[model samples]
Target: MITYVYLVCKSLSLLFSSSALDTSIITYDQTHLKTPRFPLTDLELASLYENWLVGHGKTYNAAGEKERRFEIFKDNLRFIEEHNSVNRSYKVGLNRFADLTNEEYRSMFLSGTMKRVKLNRMPGRNNSNRYVVRVGETLPKRVDWRERGAVNSVKDQGQCGKSICVFMCLFVSFIFLLVEGINQIVTGNLVSLSEQELVDCDRSWNKGCNGGNVDYGFRFIINNGGIDTEKDYPYRGVDGTCDQNRRNRRVVSIDGYEDVPANDENSLKKAVANQPVSVAIESSGRDFQLYQSGVFTGSCGTSLDHAVVVVGYGSENGIDYWIVRNSWGPNWGEK
Candidate 1:
């Protein structure tokens, strides 16, 4: 059965939203994530491609396009098989994104804000530079806000270039959680905020479906008085004009946001130990596209291209991982 996750609640307001992880579209054998691999013949390749298409419930509009996608799928299959044939910590498998070329994949899924970024002082941003961890303090071995019922749900950006499901999709959900977490810390109430509100109205810098800056989103919230609830605005996965009435129904609000020191894992851990933090990472590698499971300490690049949330952190048999709240939907990860 397939389940749809509408988390961009439309996609991103600052960062790129998930374009594939319907996480409705999950696959790869349980064995695939941690099992052995072997070579496949031409006949095997043809058969596998057919099965993948059927299983994913996919159809191309034209025969030529289908053929093109098949070739792309074949190339991706070779990469997955080659990587998995080796004994490695992580494995790759055929997911919904298999037919897409890397360039096509990045264009559709990765937000532009994550690329070619030039950092500057964000106007009206909170100026605090430190997370304030005491000298004697030590982080716990693991922290998972999902286990503690702090996370809301997984989201899928579909084909969104960004999320409220417009330009940058993941931030639509992450920022919602970030503020919700903070609100819970203060009011002890959990409310789902509307990502659509940001998508439609925050046009000063955000591009809706083209991508936008993540940092600018917080200030937009403060200046707008507050944000609306998801029920109030709802996600449409496409661009729409801002609704004047619903746009003003601010259900949740924040005082301001602070930035974490760059290249500082300790400070990051300290922050994650306390609450879910918005973050970006380089997710352009083909391996990242087909990742099945196991800690994703990857073969990806340093070029930041995607945005996600660090809800918590933990260590497992010496392997440490951040509990990332990706907008790829529930089916994509640890459901």
Candidate 2:
């Protein structure tokens, strides 16, 4: 069963017209570019058996299930090969989402229920502060919190619609480490914060395993003093009893978080230059779903249905982009 709801909104401003002229090309080292390997036709049969045995290709003992998965894998491979065949600004390939159809893929993987809260804007303030690049204020061409050792490995949210919880956990955890200084992260003393604790325990205004706002989650952290590490309150995906014993394992507290003024890409860049920042952007487009690697100058909409983290920003082949860290898992993008 597959379902989809097409959202009609403003087209992404990423794909630039010839009239737009401020962007510069940014290049990456060839060695760092990851080209995903898809299953070859010659080895498909053998790979299918291996995958089935490992509980991947099939579920029920029903006939034709294996064949269905194989066909799906071939479709995925064809999509990748076709997209990469010609030179493009970005690359696309088979990841964990390879086998699912567009509808199934969106339903299972991109189910973050983001509430559209209208932010109150102050009168006369431009949507954002004017862009002023300070003297000697150059940022790195690229920055990944994972490389800085402040971010944990990419986490799979599974079938749970709790991406809000996951992003909240990632945001708070990384910010805590950033405030504690790089020494703790370098010394391996930083703890992986618990998303499950937020899932099960954050009852102020959040629904466990359903979805919630990041601001509410942050307020929960502030009122509760802190949140537990992943070791103390492991992720169960589904809602569970909030373990009171694990509450004492809190390691960091959130004072508060400020929202970047709406549609302010410049402010977003500066915020990310300092630390990873949680962001919600429209990701229901097929182009976003198939994103494999490189800077994603999107064909995305402005509906803002999903939450992601902006780890850095840079240009690729004259297109400026945000280096987004997704929660779909390490297999989904450049990990």
- Per-residue CA lDDT of model 2 for 180-241, tens digit only, reads 33324446565666777777788776676555656667667777788787777876666778
Error of 1 at 156 (Å): 1.0
- Give Cα-based local distance difference scores for all models: 0.64, 0.53
TM-score (all chains, Cα) for each model: 0.81, 0.70
Residue-level lDDT of model 1, residues 1-335, one tens digit each, is: 11211111011111112223222122333332222234666776676677778766779998598889989998887787777666654555677788988888777777643553343565556546567566897877766665666667545677453333534566666677788777776677777788878877888877775556776678789888999888889876666799989988888888777777666677777887778788776677777676654455555455677777776665544555565666664334444
| Winner by TM-score | 1
In every candidate, how many clashes are there?
A: 33, 1
Give Cα distance to truth, residue 175, candidate 1, Å: 2.1
242, model 2: CA deviation in Å?
1.8
Candidate 2 ranges with C-alpha deviation above 4 Å:
1-63, 118-142, 159-189
Provide the global lDDT of candidate 1 against the true structure: 0.64
In candidate 2, which residue pairs get closer than 3 Å at backbone N, Cα or C atoms, i.e. clash?
25-318
